[model samples]
Target: MDEVEVVVAHSERATLRVGDVFLKVDGDRARAGVEARAMALAPVPTPEVLWHRPPVLAIAALPGRALAQLGRPSTASPAAWAAAGAAIRTLHDAPLPPWPGRSADDLAAALDVECAWLVADGVLPRDLVARNRRIAEAALRPWTPVFVHGDLQPSHVFVEGERVTGVIDWSEAARGDALFDLALLTLGHREHLGDVLAGYGTGPDLDRDVIRGWWVLRSLLTVRWLAEHGFDPAAPGCEIDVLRARL
Candidate 1:
């Protein structure tokens, strides 16, 4: 069998081929609908997922591009940023799952378990798991968390042109503040500060600064991710500086 990813089975039919089966996504049969505004600019097409297998997952084949292959521009085009901001809002606005019976610690432990390999490799996190455990201690305003694409790293976002064609690999979706999404975006494009936040509609009240902080934190936090994953930290060039600048 040809293994496409370390986790993916190589069988052409994909059914019952995976080592740890999860949900099948394309099976949802959900359409993009009018919510399709910003998705038109990507190079890859987001075909409706044909099925979803639960817990772990299988979806229709993606356009077959790796996230690393899409080199970053100094900034996304203005139009692209606008679309991204809108796409984020739409995702945030979607209905979320009910709070799981677990506490915030349970959530952190979940991440730690999934990332055990990376952590064992020496990737240090921003105490996110710890932080979540103590969110009740923070003095920040209390807003109910909403559904967030927990792992919005560049690796999860698919692009074609100025638009994001498909966003998959949602093993970490959760209920959280929207800043989590913005944080991931801002970290991905530190130099494109304006492009990352442009055209974001906050309606009346939103903390732009907090969003920016999370942006910086995401970059710092990812260093831990890369290092733990057995990637050469220095090979990326400026990995330490990148982490230092934000951390």
Candidate 2:
């Protein structure tokens, strides 16, 4: 019998791996449904769904390693990063999902709440929070909605020798700004931004300021959640460092 390996386990959800299969156990059936639907709609490669039984959704593992992990150097080559960018572009160009993403007002309100908590709780210095908040404001502007993976973290992207094999974790999938996905993909890995943009083919057309804003915005918003979820947001090269980078 194959030993069960815990991939990730938090209050909201957990993922376990048994041999070649991954079982995602999510209490929110609606989110799970979105994941399934998003995977089906995504033009890029996704793991085959073995079966879905209530809280447990089993899927076959893809054929490559993750693009990278937070706070760790990526082993993937520039080509692999570019491949990921290309895959992301394809997804963004696809038909929009039925559901909408968080509106600018909602994001601003959340940012305000999180920023206050960060300072009031002494989680981060006021100056740091203030500066990042200002930087984050750039991302609040209007944007044309597109199909977004919503949580396009580097670890969600998989590659095998310069070829993108698959992307995973689609519960957050919705119609959102394309730059948000690009920002998330390159978070903590700024060195690869050029390569990604090269493949994304945005060239000079991309608004780098907005991407930078998202970097600060996302880091600020996730720090507390990460800490509560048993993750070290202050770890080297993690969310804290990303926010400090703006300083």
Error of 2 at 168 (Å): 0.7
User: Over the stretch 1-247, how does candidate 2's per-residue lDDT look in tens digits?
Assistant: 9999999999999999999999999989989989998999999999999998877889999999999998999999999999998999899889999988899889999999999999999999999999999999999998888899999999999999999999999999999989999999999999999899988886443899999999999999999999999999999999999998887
Q: How many times do residue backbones clash in model 2?
A: 0
Model 2 residue 185 CA deviation (Å) reads 0.5
Residue 34 of model 1 has an lDDT of: 13
Model 2 misplaced stretches (Cα beyond 4 Å) = 203-205
Best by lDDT: 2
Global Cα lDDT for candidate 1:
0.46
Model 1: which ten-residue window has the lowest total lDDT? 30-39
Positional deviation of residue 72's Cα in model 1 after best superposition, in angstroms: 4.8
lDDT accuracy of residue 148 in candidate 1: 66
On the 0 to 100 scale, the lDDT of residue 222 in model 2 is 96
